[model samples]
Target: MTRAKLFSGILISICFGLFLSACSNGESESKDTKKEEVRTATDAMGEVTIPANAERILAPNMEDSLLALGITPPAQWAIGTTVHNYLQPQLKDVPTIEWDLPLEQTINAKPDIIIFGSPGSIQNGKYEEYKKIAPTYVFKEEESADWRKQLQVMGEIAGKEKEAKAVLEDYDAKTKEQAAELKTAIGDETAAILWVIGKQYYLFENSRFAANVLYTDLGVTQPEMIKALPKAEAAWNPISLEALSDLDADHIFLASLPNEPGLASLKASSVWKGLPAVKAGKIYEMEDPSNWTSNGPIANNITMDQIVSVITKK
Candidate 1:
């Protein structure tokens, strides 16, 4: 009878062990499910649920903020064959999808979420089609316009709000330090940013894109011509040669492609040649215009460094 009792006790102990193992496995699965659960966020498209821990994100044109937050998108934004060259250093291996986000390509990318730069980026009636592939979040005009706000929104969507705050804090600190240095180096000298593409001459207004870094952040004085111009309605706001001739900047950062016809025209024109900045030989020609034309901490930092280098010759 004692021997029989011993055998029964051993069997009971084995069953208990099996039960605990099953319970542990169940708990692990529950934890994993919680990790992958969806949460709602209010965007330009209203409240939408997105994965709490998205493994693959696709944000077109908004790659600057995503990259600043240390997230490499599965697909980069492109216009035809053109991609943002400045971001290629980090996104060299990522595939390109059209700016409009094609249906077949969206399905193939298999993104956990799609963050459009602006509501306008959602072309045609394709919002529903994209929703079928993944949760789509569209940034409002205000959120999309300011890099800092865009970065924070990206963090909230990706469950990294703390990280976004840290990035902004660091950026603010850098801007303060660099702005002080620029003030000391250049004093109150005014500057203007001119981007030449083909035959167009687009001037950067006070708050446009990276101009905020120049006029607002770094405390550089805006030229009378730039100040007098109306707020930019488009990304590339062009100025007539007649208006450009009135530019009164001490320094001009001229961005253009090598051998661009616009540069030739500006050089040949007596009016352009007579500008104060050109006559003083203060025009700094930039072959690569990516950083100046775009916004975000990464792009703006590169821009600040270039500005400091050129102005200070350091």
Candidate 2:
């Protein structure tokens, strides 16, 4: 071979080697980028540290909050069979440990943690029992007030506190903006929020679920009839549909209760057609049950959007 040709061949070999090396380096960097980070956060119970990436998460309550943070657990414990229908689509596939959790089933799963609301469930001695199986957390179910706080707390337990904070902050800002828009759309209109559960109709005051958003956050006025009702004893109180006339407001938010007897009775009542809101078609029927009672991060957004839609939709 010619001397020049030999030198050229050597140069080509060196270039090929460098190209392979660059490709290998790029592959390594891609793998590193895909690696999951070990996240940590603190809650009221104590400091929760999820080692590396938590592969097997078990959530008992606050499924909506977990769904909001884009985390889906392998197993979850539902408040009841009916509650599962309220969860987001991603969470609907997870297996539930039944309404009242069995101690043995929880221990057998060997979950990293167990999250639950309803202080009674925690205080009833189940919390201690479950802690033996995993780190158990009890979050409050204050429909409007404690949802964000609880989401942060649960996020820490699931090793996703930063994500939780971001989700909650965005939800809060959007809720504030939507509330302002709703107030402007319904200016000076008195509104009342009510649910027809079983055979009774319940009007929510400041303390009930979603009431704080209407009464305190959006600054919407309430009718004197509803205002005169005693403060909700426990999130909601049952009222007779016979008293519908007493609940007269410029606008009425009738929570969707599919096939609920109270709803049928109200529709059938002779006085119902005469009510101002019903006659004027000012009643807004809540199609999404999640918006009525959920306190999760996504629920806040849903509620805000629904309120704005009902108030502004022509």
Candidate 3:
């Protein structure tokens, strides 16, 4: 063959090979794009049909639960500015609303659904107004302690019930394991959980609040004094600082409000320093104020870790 003809033949062969490779690559890319378009069920507050690619969402209080279920809403209906620190990274950009109050900003967001952590304030009239704008769901106050149930309800609403259930089961198993370990480490040491609010304090009893996890879930015994306090229908009972000495627990899990004067007052009080738990250096200060009262999924996990760490560390 002539040299020019031989060169032309080699060039054509190379071109043909390149064309086939490009076609193969294009086919694979098309398949991958189609697979990526596939949608799955998302469970939020209740059973609602959500597109696998739901763009706009509004989470008011249960940010932790939503995060646990891998649902990151584009917007958050926040009660306060500081709450942003508590939200998962996916929700940090969401705007904040007036704490526990309905603001026009939230309504303007035009979200598909609004999930509330606390609905009592909204129930009086605000919730109805919100319903006119979008589907709104309030967490069941009765199931406050059952975070798994809360997640399940959220998952069902978001159309991700199965995922929520699995997440709940996993969290429950971890909690149970940690609780068992905490029980062994702490042994029979009695503990009291308290929140320093303003100049007063509130003690949590086993049946009253989520603090029951310390007793019911973690197998920690309640201090006799806290157990003897007058039981009310509420989760916590308010007591005077003068009564601090009466809460004779082996250890005290005290949560103070950040930048609040309550801690200063408690420290200044002679009776507080004389308490057996205080003198023995058994007070575990909780840095996260939300964990002291929040019943959300992340808060529950935070509480469990705090309990285990405090008990086991000692």
Candidate 4:
């Protein structure tokens, strides 16, 4: 072959090789894109087949759990204009979703997976319909009040089990340190949480909200009045002043939402003044009720700080 002809032939071969290499890479990239692992997650309702790469997750009432995992979901739980207000700064831009989850609205959000805080949150037997829209998981009712179990399930759904475990381990370490400091400061002095809404009064049980941080995580002792009560329900149970006076706790953390009826009158009552915590001037009125009301990882941490600061200062 002539030199020029040989050179042209070599150029064509080079171009053809380049084209084949491109095709091979395209195929490999496409295969990698198609790789999606599936996982089986069991909850109170049943087992759900979920994608390991699920994005656009909707945890509704479990926004606290998702926040704990460092994931801001597409939507958080809403009741009209209210939600977990303590999480507002982190969730400010995220949209609020309804508890009822109107079919049209839920479909519009295009969630890849939906998680409920508890089975009771699945109103009108909408679990099957929700499954049609996306993989749905409903936790047991008990998990609603537990931050640890809530985060574990959230990590499982997000395929971030390692991240979740790390978050929990960190929280445990901090809780232990705080608990030790609190034990040293308090020295067996007991505490109690009281909430007044409308005309009714409530004594927070050991397991709910910030009380959990005080009693369970921090090992703070609950007054005999609190320990003797029947196991508390998920919601705050009501009690009368006569019953409340039985609590001789050294410290009282009184929580009340803004403008809640009868609170002013209750505070003015002689019965309230006669309580041991009040007489000793150990009553701490909470300025922001969210610390005690919103039960989540973040809230618990804040609650721990608040408890330690107030108790140690006094």
Residue clash pairs of candidate 2: none
lDDT of each: 0.88, 0.70, 0.70, 0.83
Residue pair clashes in candidate 1: none
TM-score of model number 4: 0.88
What tens-digit string does per-residue lDDT give for candidate 2 at 1-314? 99999999999999999999999999999878656444344434455434345556666656677788787766675656565455646667677776567887676666766666655655456766776776655554452137767677666666688998889678667767876787778787898887876787777876566776677667788888867878666545576666777767888888865877778888889867888988889988885555666556666566666777878993
Query: Cα lDDT of model 3 overall?
Result: 0.70
lDDT of 4 at 191: 96
Clashing pairs in 4: none
Estimated TM-score for each candidate: 0.93, 0.76, 0.74, 0.88
Model 2 accuracy (lDDT, Cα): 0.70
- When 2 and 4 are scored with TM-score, the better candidate is 4
Write one digit per residue (lDDT tens) for candidate 4, span 1-314: 99999999999999999999999999999887766566787888777788788878888877777878778888778889978777889999988888789877788888988878787888898888999998887888766557787787778789889988998898899999999999999888999988887888888877777888889899998888888887767555688877776878999998887687767877888888988889999988776777688777788888888889988994
What's the lDDT for candidate 1? 0.88
Per-residue alpha-carbon lDDT of model 3 for 1-314, expressed as tens digits? 99999999999999999999999999999998777543433322444333333445576656667787888765664555557454545666666665554556767676777666554546455766776766565666654336667777677666678888888787779878987797677788898888887776878866544476677767788888867766546444578888777888998888876666888888889988998999999898886656657666666677888888876884
Instruction: Tell me the tens digit of each residue's lDDT in model 1 across 1-314.
Output: 69999999999999999999999999999998986798888888898989888979999888888888889989998899888888899988999999888888888888999888787878897898888899988888888888989999899999889989999998889889989998998799999999888888888889887798898889899978888888877655578777788889999998787778888988889988998988998988878888888998888988888888898888
Better of 3 and 4 by lDDT: 4
